[model samples]
Target: MGISRKKIYEEIADLIMQDIKDGVLNPGDQLPSITRMAEHYQVSSASIREALNTLSVMDVIEVKHGQGSYIKERMPLGFEHEFQIITRKDIENLLDLRKIIEVGCVELACSHADEEDLGRMQDALGKMRTAVMNNELGEQADYEFHMAIAQSTGNQMLVDLLGDVSEKMLETMKETRRIWLYEEKKSIQKIFDEHQAIYRAIAEKDSGNATGAMMRHLEEVATVLLKQHK
Candidate 1:
């Protein structure tokens, strides 16, 4: 079942609270930039804004003008533990499902994508490059570029399926990114290269290359999470 929009906002709020309770975030600590939070939460800026606002209304955080949102000295009531929603097995399942859908979608996109689709993907890649330059994880741009490939497939069912599971996928993506970027100490250029390969293959209308690229990306994701699970 698809998650409701309101529930997504609440979930984002809970993720932040979990970080706080774990002592990963401290009072007076400025939260990650809104863009970073939106990527990590797999929500839009508006949704993140609403989530932040919800925290503010509950007096859990303070949003100061001319500055970003800050953790407040006082936490809302009953935030003693993390609100975990899924297990490692669940994340592995999602990556497997994504591989099945996305690999096929890329094959279709190779034949169906037009110049406009290519342009959208190019723009997303540009954003990714900029994110890397700024020492950001570029998760949102990475999602959008893959989404552009799905969009190019011109199959509403494929598109709908991806959208339905995207929320769950976003959560796993955060974990995967954290491992590769921070825990594993991997170079960010590897991520950029993988994405660039996918884009170039699609741009060249090469289904074989696109399928292989998609598989490589998804396989790495699944492998990382599975390793973490073990």
Candidate 2:
């Protein structure tokens, strides 16, 4: 049997949820209009509107009358009302998925990266170094460096996915850093070294090494998060 409209709505809801959880739809970001979303998902506008309304009721989004639907920024609470819900496991799974995708991206980037890509990466690295030395604005530089790598892949879909993953990781890292009472120096240096390793691998067009380096870096970060949570 063909999938029912209810099932289609659920599928759309799930995709939106994944995007939200990954931070692609940031707080206050307006979603596409119902008609646009409906067209994209090959569903009725009414179904899209219903899904948005459901999300709004769950506090995952807000729909303003005569305005549009916007993502909400509330932190997920455990065992709360249906409004806000997320678990530690969910965060871990997201991080794992990010690592998998990033490994592939690094491989592709190494194969396709150009001089302009290298230049942009160098700029990001320079900013990161300055931020580390000056003890200011490190987070932004760190994000830029990773984003540069994602851009090097020359794949819009991968770039977009990384953007979403990076945003979530940034928020989670901020919280993890606070909880661990960690200083930025050692972490920054470690990340700088890993970035250098990845850059060198890409420059040499060593896809295997590029993917390995990226995975190692992600594993290190994951280890830190797990330890902090423990």
Candidate 3:
């Protein structure tokens, strides 16, 4: 039997999700127009619109009346409940998935990133440093650093997905950090050092080192979370 309209919409959603998973559709990048998408998917424009609406409610994308549909910034970590029912297990899964995806993204970014992209990453890192030194909210800065790397991959979907994932993780980390209070200053310093390592690996165009650095950072984060739960 032929596919139904509902099935078509579902497929469209899956396509968008896959793009995010593969790092093709980046955050902040405008989605192709309904007409364009319809032509690409060989579906009715109405179906495409419906799929886009669903993504919008999920905070996966934002449709600004006139400007067009763009990916939304990542939601702050603890704010997942505001949009969806994200459980602790979900958070753990997200962390694992992020570890795998981010490692690849860093490796790709090291090879693909240009001077302008590197400059942007350095700028984000500088913000993180300032935030840590001033005892301000560094979560955003940290988020930016990762997002910048995702951007460097020249993949819009990957950038958007990572931004969304990181945003939620950052919120979770903020709450966890507050509860643990394990040498706040020292912990912050460790984070800075870890970020520096990732940055250096990317700067040197060493994909292997970048992946390794990312893994170490994620491992440290996971270790902390595990200890807190125990």
Candidate 4:
């Protein structure tokens, strides 16, 4: 029964990919409503959602919390192999890398961030607030906030490095947020607050506080995510 259910969702994912290839769904196109797709595919909503999640993790679709999922600008190369091999350990390693990179980033930002940098981070916060109100994941805004911190460091090399792996970072955020929201039953407001704390510490130019906040935020997410695998 489990094997059959998994096959169904994978078939649905393949069908959606075919639609994209056929130009039935174009880049930046919002997918049909889940309910609509469920009825059309004669599958449960859970199965439809699983298919969408699979595509989203594969970088084939972008899932917004309140907004519907949309086709990505480009499909990832070698996604099938990635879908097969992605594991909890991969997520754990990613979270560890973030702790190493981002905690130091916020500390540097406390020293170098100008008003313009703060403005960008604040702008991201505002967008996150709107997303929370709308009951969305706010993943894009969350990504922007972290990028803004990297930018605030005035380190072009670091910015470029993060940009190169931006796709993976965004995917990690989506996965952890899903775990936090759906699996852990966390409130969106609480999640937003973690980012807010990091922002506040940087804005205040307190390196000690900024690093602590960033570390805590990443660690909290890591604990929640890793716990699930156990």
Whose TM-score is greatest here?
A: 1
lDDT tens readout by residue for model 3, 167-186: 56776555444322322434
Write down the worst ten-residue block by lDDT for model 2: 176-185
| RMSD to native, candidate 1 | 12.5
Worst 10 residues of 1 by lDDT: 75-84
Q: What tens-digit string does per-residue lDDT give for candidate 2 at 53-80?
A: 6565445678888998887766433112
Residue 204 accuracy (lDDT) in model 1: 86
| Order of models, best lDDT first | 4, 1, 3, 2
TM-score of each: 0.65, 0.57, 0.59, 0.64
TM-score of 4: 0.64
Pairs clashing within candidate 3: 23-158, 24-156, 24-157, 25-156, 25-157, 26-156, 26-157, 27-160, 77-168, 77-171
Instruction: Give each model's whole-structure lDDT.
Output: 0.77, 0.69, 0.73, 0.79
Tens digit per residue, CA lDDT, model 1, 158-181: 888988988777656655665575
Question: Candidate 4 lDDT, tens digit per residue, 71-185?
Answer: 9876543222223334567767878778888887898999999999999999999999997897667889999999999999998977887787788777667656655554336
lDDT (C-alpha) at residue 199 in model 2: 86
Query: Clashes per prediction?
Result: 0, 0, 10, 2
Off by over 4 Å in 3: 1-86, 176-181
Error of 1 at 169 (Å): 1.9
